[model samples]
Target: MGSAAPAFYGRRVPLFFNPLEAAAHRLSIAPPMFDYFNTLGLHALVAAARLRVFDALRERPSTADGLATTLTIDPRTAEVLLRVLAGLGYLRVKGGRYRLTRTSRTWFTTDSPTSLVAGLEFWERTACVIWPRLAEAVRDGSPVTPFYELLESDAALSRSFQAWTAALARRQAPATARIIPVPRDGGHVLDVGGSHGLFSVELLHRHPGLRATVLDLPQALEAAADHPRLTLRAGSFLDDDLGEGYDVALLFNIVHGLDDQEVAKLFARVAAALNPGGAIVIGDQFRDSLMPGRASRTLLDLLDLNYRVATGGRVRDFREVARMLRAAGFDRPRHRRPLRSVVTELAVAVVKSPSRP
Candidate 1:
């Protein structure tokens, strides 16, 4: 009947059925389900990082049972975790032994120079906890827990935040120092909202003639290392008087947390704090300058969401930033060469002389 309906595999098939089309349909339908489970891989990776699995593997390759014995984890659990990590390309497995891949060795090992363990820890501990409340943030148009308020309530979390941020800052500071133009002549540098002060320290190292003053919360500054060329000022960037006549001012990774008015006010304060010929270097991730890739765009969007949830702030577009800087009575701003990092592009803007009459 009807030419046997193109029977295949001893079953009748629809006359219009196409194998390619069926395969495409299957793929289209599978991604959402696949994506849901894919996220679990990220969580597992973060957990393994926290548990120092990579660190243990860094010492030497070991069978899952051996690793379990060394780390005091269940053997079956360790094997499963190791298998997952191997599947993810962070580890290599052969002869029932696992070892860190070059990628993991470079980034996951605690002792590696470019290790990202601290930054990853920050994501696991802080951002991961907050992300579950994203729906509430979307509904309320803000994060369920304000970032600063959360820090205020939890001393341990606050310390962890500082440590992770400091670690991340240290990783990027060298590249940032290379890109930004520091005046050759010795001049005072003001770091507004410079929590860890690593940027200032790196800059001071680059320019021995310069001295830096870091203004941030007392808790954030408590862990800052003492330096002959560095001074730590404890207070709010919003209410505190940023002392005047500094040759250069830094507003690094600070603008995204503030609303437009606060950002404008901050620029005004920075303008007031600088010497007539001084420059204010604003270092942040400008939305317009993000790297050209789908991954980068996705990351930028996530960061925008993160800011929106945590502080009712957003990643500023370059045009908006320049407009704000102009409104704050600074001359036209110039963008320096951008430094691309794992998280965001380190964008630097140098404002011409302050317009204070």
Candidate 2:
């Protein structure tokens, strides 16, 4: 028999990653041959975030040399990075001094309620590790290991994800609260997988008679704020006791992370838990619902692929969601775009009751 070539994946792939060198290249994009698999353009921003470049600039406009002294970076190096950030539109440069652009102030500072800084950390520390093995997930039609399993083991990665989720929730919750059809008479809501509990808080503020329970895993609920009307129920929405007779069940950004069978089961469970005439509002990125060439069409498709790689899940169309809901005893569902967001929309269904009929 001819000698077999050395195997590719079953053994150690040589790692050229140097933490110091990676840190040294902090202000620049890693060369194409960079050790980790981060996407190209993002590395520049990641480097700046890591170096707290945005934070320093936010304090006051500063020349490269001044920032270098404050940040303990070499002046020459800081100049190059500052110029790059300005070019990237994250900062503005004039009079040899750099300062935060509106974009940076809104989304980069850690203190900003909608800050996306943790997004970079999640991508670098968690998502990149999953990307290299994405092919296996695709070919197998499931994630090699589900996303939460990985997070369960890595506290740092989990915290980064939680922070990102919370920031995103803060941006979207108010709009969602406005759009969601809370019962007019004021009843209970089941906020399924409501990790950050921002939605529940918003709903309670909007409707005085509304009481909400945010059901999610215990770890995800750690940062969830307590409210007299908002109960944090730590458990699985898939297998655990979801209390019955909820007036509204909000499944936001959830279904894309579950398989079809799991979605069907969960929908049935949701059906059983809702009161007569109660509505279910599912907020998610539906790939088929986006118009062709829409601004967020690509983002929706990317999320579909990302979900596939992370949880054996894929995006569903409004039709698919409606069919599942109908099978679970809901009336025909309506797809509504309530938020200014192009990607996330709601598919709402109501449990039929004799009074409503």
Candidate 3:
């Protein structure tokens, strides 16, 4: 993959401090005044994505009128959208035709392996629904219905969410697989709540002798890949059997959606499902302790709110994660950041003898 996808989201370090937010803080302005929305350019990008404008320009350049004819939209609106896209550097106009920039061609087109189209669609479907209801969540201390429940009821939303998450898993799989302590000779691997199965697939690719199982909801596994070395089990990781005698278990990006009680129970369940001497790798954006305030890790701070709004969950800090692991009968967990993307991290814990307490 190219380097753009990582940077497109954000950087690992803060480039500058925002004195405006500080001024707002001094004046006691509501946080929403600054935090409520993205810049208009981002909203434009999302609109273009949902409209499939990037896909239209993927194969060949087109004038605004030509694109409007192809997409069956008002020519004037199409012209404005194209101009906006071009102005934002995602598109370039030459000889009265518009085309994708190199970064756009690589990461935004549907044909690209690293396409972020699903991500944009997902943002439209999920974030748009979640953010507007954030005040209610903050007030009631929970979403009216959890985001997963909402997804379960709506097929289109569920598919969009899965597609986006799977795209993310594909990009992150390589970076994640490297740090996980999979046994050299290859033993059983369990991927708990591994909805899209890309992580397990990556591990299988790396360790030829490894066999893996992806456990997730039935709806989530519908598009999961079938392989000779892979098994797909459909069920809730919280309330179902996790199967025993696993050498390595992967818990990736699923914890932020869970409550503290649920996390404790799930970790204990996974610990029981693993064989003695097995390792479990937990991956997500843990709350950064050093820079936990609004000035730094801003996305993470937003994500902490996102979790609360979407799932009644909050980002757990490093020490809290280790405490959960230790309470589940594992030793102190070791932390690793394979990609250094600042969006996610890994914590590895080993099961001692007599695996389940």
Candidate 4:
């Protein structure tokens, strides 16, 4: 059967087909479905390991009954879930005993430095809940999603979120540090929303003279406490005072989460903080509709809806960001396309002189 569905009652139905045809039809729509599947997949994989199924298997391949007793699950249900996971390649079965596959060994190993277990935990614990409200976010024009509001009210949830955010920065910090220029001649850096102080750590490692002030919620300081080169301050970017006279300030992935008015205020603050001849870098997925041969950027416009709903923030297009920079009293914006995703554009705005407030 062809992948395309036939029409019925003003809507196409894939279930009308035979079992093989229905499976093929489902595979045809798997691209969009994969987004939904990714939520459960990563987390489930983590949860299984957390429940000690892998460790149980590590000692020796075990029958489902053995795994169930060790993992505290019912034998019959554990058998079903195990077989499904084995089919999905997380495990393998031989002689009626289940074993962890190589795919599980690489990332699922607790000792692996590059393990994605934290990433999976963040998804299972949060993103899965937030994504269901995408349509509501699109309709409401509000950046704060129900998930964020929930976080504000729930202290435990908020802490989990902060931890996940910090983990993400820590994991990606080395890569970011490699790309960002660290001045050897001695200059301070302002790490805007500097979660975990990864940026500061990486920068200071590269340049001995660089000191950084990480401006974020005080709760975020938990991740930054050990970094000698970083000083953590607690305050909102809009309401808090950003200290004056820095040579280079970084607004990495910060602008995308705020509205135009909020971004304008932030720019004005950043401009005030910079010394004359200083530079401000706005690193984010700056939307570029014209980029040739790249569909990922275009697709990100859809993914950004999650940010909009959950945090009261909106991702910016390149043009929108440039205009905001100019309005905040900066010279023309300079942009660098560092990655294929629209999220990775680094827009640097130069502060030539202090503007009269």
Q: Give the alpha carbon lDDT tens digit for every residue of 1-357 in model 3.
A: 111111123222122225664455555662433233244656878878777788999867899999888889889988998887776668888988999888677667888877877667557755556677888988999864578877777767777778878877777889888878888888999998787798899999999999999998887887787778999998888888888999998988888889999998888888888888899898887774434544346567777888888888788887899988998888868888877335668889998753442
lDDT agreement of model 1 with the native: 0.75
How high is the lDDT of residue 322 in model 4?
86
Which 10 residues in a row give candidate 2 its minimum summed lDDT?
A: 1-10
TM-score: model 3 vs. ground truth: 0.84
RMSD of each: 8.4, 9.6, 5.5, 6.4
Give TM per candidate.
Answer: 0.86, 0.85, 0.84, 0.75
Tens-digit lDDT track for model 1 on 227-320? 8999999888888888887887888878898888888788887887787767777777787776776546766888899888778788988778
Worst 10 residues of 3 by lDDT: 1-10
Candidate 3 residues lying further than 4 Å off, grouped into runs, are 1-43, 87-89, 93-96, 289-296, 340-342, 355-357
CA shift at 157, candidate 3, in angstroms? 1.2
Error of 3 at 274 (Å): 0.8
Instruction: Please name the candidate that would achieve the greatest TM-score relative to the true structure.
Output: 1
Candidate 4 lDDT over 138-194, as tens digits, reads: 787774355534654665655656655555555556656666655668788988887
Model 1 error, position 23 (Å): 5.3
lDDT of 2 by residue, 1-357 (tens): 011211111212222335664444553454434323325436777888888888888888899999999989889977987776775567788889898888788888877888888777887754558777878977887777678767767767777788887787788888878988887778999999988888789999999999999998877887887788999887899889787889999998889889988898888888888998889999887766786653256456667778888788888888988998888888979998866555568999998751211
Off by over 4 Å in 1: 1-27, 119-121, 339-357
In model 2, the clashing pairs are none
Q: Which RMSD does model 4 reach against the true structure?
A: 6.4
